[model samples]
Target chain A: MDSVVFEGIGKRYRSLWALRGVDAAFRQGEVVMVIGPNGSGKTTLIKCLLGLVRPSEGTVRVNGQLVGSDPAYRQRIGYMPQISQFPPALTIGQLLEMMRDIRGLDAETVDDTLVGALGLDRQLEKRLSTLSGGTCQKVSAVLAFRSRPSILVMDEPTAGLDPLSARTVLDQAAALRSNGGTVLITSHLLEEVETLADRVAYIEDGRLRFLLPVKEILQRSGATRLAQALPVMLSNSATP
Target chain B: MTKVYKYTLVDLARNRFVLAFAVLMLVLAEGLFRIEGDAMKAMLSLVQVTLALVPLVTLVFTIVYSYDTQEFTQLLAVQPIRRSAILAGRLAAIATAVLMALAFGLGLPLLVHLPGMVSLLLFAANALLVLVFVALGTLLALTQRDKARGVGIGLVTWFLFVLVYDALLMALMFALSDRPIEPWVVPLAALNPIDLARIAVMLRVDLAAMMGYSGAVYQRFFGSAQGILLALGLMVLWAAWPALVAFRVFRRKDL
Candidate 1:
């Protein structure tokens, strides 16, 4: 079953159309990496799915329910925004406690694996403002995954992480995909997507250029690596 | 809503700026009381200071806090909560923090020195003023996307409320002093929370002679219990209108 669907989504900010007629669907268990250059509306597409940006047209469906109709559906979605914006005054521990309190999730149901994996447990007492950009990103990751969400939406999840931390995130995404959880991510790292994404969503100039499986992309372009295959595939697809 | 409010309050409690504001108020109030050596005189001095200072502080602080929490607001927006809860919670937390600062800084001084009905009314008036400005600040923050512009607008709003509005009203009154405009001008006070608060406390303080023409009219018109209630009701309306509009804007706004 399709766990998430965006039907002809369109978003306009003042004069610029950030997204126009974007349509796609993610299966119950798949990792789809959204690929686009800067200012290509990749984040806007993800925001529309998260209901952070209301689509000027069309609708988003999560678990077969309309996105804006109810917020309860978000309980199943774990989102890590590209920029970490937790309260600056809060310690990492306090922020975690606050999220748990907001969700009303008890101790037994809460997942703290990322807390240990991200090394956030040791730095729990550090205020968000005091943490470096990389550490803050890890905190965002821990919060995103801690809820044990069925549908995960991570926007450039590994943008600021070190290689080791980035690997842990990828492993977590892979583990979640294997457990039948859907993961939607956007990253500039095509190599990471090579091993992680089941499918690739290439968005450019505020439009979805293509949505194809990874194996098909490699096969169609006749390139072994995604880095070389994507350009060839886009040019080939653009021509025909 | 309570969850948002609780966490926001927790975040605010950790803020040193708010603590400094409280301390500043305490020092000012205590200083005035010590110099005057009389509770009533000290309160009169404090009233003038707060009339200008409280709104300015609340507006600036609220605007900065709202802008700083943009990321936090975005984070909460994707959660399983209504937009209204997020807005109301943050607004309530700002109000609570400012009110606590006022209560400790000013209210405690009043309770220690005056300890009477007039002082209590003064505290209530200050509290209402805080709410009104916080509402205005929230509206300003939500409307203006740029932080510098928002803070600039906030300062202008404080100026208009604390100084410009009264100046315009007084100028109009003096220009129209020949006509029977005093009665009509009484309602105009309701348009400004600062004016309403000033009139409300002045009446209780029994300062009709000091009250200008409009204030005298307010005293005469709303001198009774029903009149005081009516003024407070108007202040509450002032406190709520901007916040309600801000909430509506937030509902459809792209975070």
Candidate 2:
């Protein structure tokens, strides 16, 4: 069974169909990248898979269980939203501690890992309001990666990170996949996706335009860079 | 379920806003009791502020909290926990936090006066109000989705409860002055939670002279076993209606 599956999944919001007939499966130890332009239903797909938004048609299953039926499916998955809002009053340490407490994970080891990797030990006491955008993004990254759940779903995970922070996140994603974890990530940055993804799923206007192995896509497009190859694929798909 | 509740309580306790509000309530209640010189008046005043105003404030706060934590909620949704359990955990955390604040705010004053059965009754009344309003606020938040709109609806509902409902009732009474509808108005008066709270407390103080004609009217009809039961039922309904609506909406919502 696949680690995550979307079979004929569709989501309708009023008159707008945010996603239509999305069919895909993600396997353990695979790093899949979902790429699309803004308003192309990337977030909607993620939300549907997470069971935050119910699909209007078809089913979304994770690890052979329907997401809607089992709430604990989320416990096996770690999600980093595109934009996170932390309570201004809470210190970085306090926020991380709260998340750990909510998930019922031990604090000592997780805290140590977070401090060492993210260099958050010195900034632990600083309130979230006092942190810069990049710093806040670092905190979010630490929280998402700390639990090391079997399945990781991150939306625009590296949006505001410094180059080093971004590299650390990418390395972590690669490590998780090497450990037989399923990692699904979405981003507008083509380079990150090209480097980290084993499979690429391209979406346009709420429809799946293409899904193929990263190497196949790169070879077929005959473009040296994913940034160049993406446009060719989109233009070709746009005609039909 | 127990684990969820425990974790929820911990989360609520750690929230800085809840902590600050709880402390502020206690301080205010203490100050009111010291200045009032009358125990009943102090209690009455505290109930008005705590049950009426605090719940409204807390309800709006909860709505905003839920909206602001959309990402967090999304993260939790992918977990092994049931969606209902997640919502229940959140609701339980919010309800317990609000109740604790109410208790500390009003409980301190009651302790000073050494309230009897009357205190328990007041507490029950206040609890009903809090539950009803929180549920209403949740439903409003779910329905509106927008933070500003939800807060606006909450404020309007508060105004209706605190001001408009009574104003409308008074207008109706004046319009019906010629019909001698005093007997029929007794049941209608029981419909309002604010009125019920006022009557419950006033009855404890002195139903005979303090309530005047309204007191006699209450005693004549609702003063009976069945009438009192009916009044209590209305209060329960007030608490139940919004909660039931919220639960149903939440169950189906694509949050």
Candidate 3:
């Protein structure tokens, strides 16, 4: 069964439709990279799945449960937002502890893989306001992975990180995939998409243009690289 | 909800804004008490100051804080936390922090100088004003997505409640001076939360005569237990209605 499904999802903001009839599904043990231009509903689609934005029409199902009022389904999901802004007054340790408490996880049982890997344990005393953009991103990455979620949604997860940190993040996502966790990522980095994505979900103009495998995209476009194949695939079938 | 509230309260406490407000209140109230040299007189003076400052500070702070925590709100929204919890937690924390400041700044002086029913009433009035304005601020913040616009609206809202509403009422009273406007004026005064708070405390201190016609009208109309109950009910409603509406708005709101 699909771990997540967006069935004919539609979201309209006043006169503008931010997302219209967006239908897609992510199977377990696969990383689906959501790709799109700016304001093309990539974030909107992810927000809809996370119940951050309510759809104007249609339903979303996760683990066969309908997404609406109950937030229980969110427990199994981890999200790393593109913008990393936490309570500036809080130390990194306090923020992490708060998240752990909210999730009702014992401190002893909490996962510290990301914290250790990102070197956040040492800087846990630092206030969020004092951290640089890259450090904040690392903290966000830690929060997303600390919960050991079955489904991961990362929006521009590597936009601000140094190359090494970004590589670590991609590796973590890969590890999650190896463990049969489903990952949904949106990125402008086609290179990262090619390396990490099992299926590429393309969205444009508030609609899902295509959701194809990397190999299928390369084969259909007769191109050796995903960067070359994306344009060909998009142009060939503009209405998917 | 408790976890969110706990974290938010801790965050607010750690931030200097709440503490600064607390210290300012303490100094002001302490200075007033020292200068006046009379507990009743100091409490009376504080009534006016609290009535103005509580709403203005609460309005501006809540709106600004809401915008500041938008990203954190997103993080919470993706967690297992309900939107209502998120909304309630933030509002509660704002109220708690502001109320704490009011208590330390104003409550301490009131407790030390004037330990009476009137001082207690003034404290309650300040607490209620915090609730009303915080709710209004939450509404303004949620309705206006842009931070500058939200804060702008908050200022206008404060102006309308604090100064404009009274000015309008005074104008209405003057225009209708020839007629007995008590019947209409009573409900009109009740419409503004600030007016309601002022009247409640003003009447408790037996300073209605000093409040001019509006106070006399309220004393005559709301002097009875039933009328006071009705006023109290209205004040409670003032605190709750906006918060309830904001909660609904937040639930339906797309983050």
Candidate 4:
């Protein structure tokens, strides 16, 4: 069974259709890079999959289970939103402690790898509001990886980070994929997409424009690099 | 739910705005006691102060906090927690923090100086009032996304309940003074949660006259034990109904 499935999902807000009759499946243990133009429903599709946005029609099945109304269903998924801001009063340590309690994880089970790589231990006692944008993004990335979830859904995970931090994040994400975690990621960074994706899912104007393997996309576009190939793919899809 | 409730409570307790309100309550309570000298007189003045201010602070603070906490709430929404639990935890924590500020800021001071059932009733009424308004504000937040508009709605809601609702009710009663509107009194009072709380506290504090002609009519019905229960029940329903509405909106809301 597919790890995630969106079956005829449609979302509309006051006549503005965010996603319309969108159907797609994320194969088990495959890295699917969700690429799309701004406001083309990429984020909407992702939110729908996570049950943050209820669909106007149809359903989402994750590992053959219905997505919303069940806390247990979310335990196997790790989500890193494109933008996240937590309460300023909480220290990083406090937030982590809260997360641990919420997830019912043992205290000893904290994922030290992401924490160490991000150097969050040094900043654990600092208040969340005191951190800079990139630092906050680092905290969000680290927290998403804390539970060793079977699925990771990330939105622009590397957008705010410095080059070195971005590289480290990509390295960790690739390692997670290698360990059989199914990832549904969205990014505008073509290099990150090429390095991290096993397949590409492109959406435009609330429609799935293309869902293709990296090689096929590259071959069809007649370009070796994702940055160059993306334009060709988008142009080819735009014609009809 | 317990974990979320704890963390949220801890977070709100340390909120600088809440802390400032806490200090204001403590100072006011202490000053009012000194000014009145007599505990009963002081308690009466404090009751009026709390009744006006609690709803205002609770409503405005709640709407602002609710607006500000959307991002974090979104984070919690995606967590492995039930939708209802997420809401329940946050509201419970807000209510708890509001209650703590009330108790520690004013209740503690009054307990030390006056140390009577009147002070206790004031505390109880104020606590219930905060919960009711917070639930109301949370519902407003859930229904409306625009921060300015939500805050505007919340302010108007506070103004209506604390001041205008009673004035309008009294005006209606005055317009029909010759007729026997006695039958309409308790039910009308029951319409506003703040009024329900006021009646509950007033009856206990021996200020039935302040309630006026309708107060005299209300005294006949709410004076009874059954009426007291009804009043308390109405207040609980007031707090609960909005919470239920917000939860329904929340579960179906596309954040």
DockQ for all models: 0.77, 0.44, 0.84, 0.79
lDDT of 2: 0.76
Instruction: Give lDDT tens digits, candidate 4, residues B143-217.
Output: 998999999999898888889998999899999999999888888888898888778778877678987897788
Q: What is candidate 3's TM-score against the reference?
A: 0.96
Report the Cα lDDT for residue A10, model 4: 86
- lDDT, candidates in the order shown: 0.89, 0.76, 0.89, 0.86
**Model 2 CAPRI quality:** acceptable
lDDT of model 1 at residue B169? 91
Q: What digit string (tens of lDDT, one per residue) describes model 3 on residues B115-174? A: 888888788878888988899999999999899999998998889988999999999898
Clashing pairs in 1: none
lDDT tens string, model 4, A1-240? 488898888889998888888788887768999988899999999888777998888799988999767768788888888887888889998998898789889978767687878888899999987899898899898878888888899999999998888888877778888887789889988786687788998888898888888888888889999888988988776331
Q: Which parts of model 2 are misplaced by more than 4 Å?
A: A86-115, A121-132, A238-240, B1-36, B41-51, B177-187, B207-214, B221-233
TM agreement with the true structure for every prediction = 0.97, 0.87, 0.96, 0.96
- Cα error, residue A175 of model 4, in Å, equals 0.8
Model 4 TM-score is 0.96
User: Model 1 segments beyond 4 Å from truth?
Assistant: A237-240
Backbone N/Cα/C clashes per model: 0, 11, 0, 0
Error of 3 at B165 (Å): 1.4
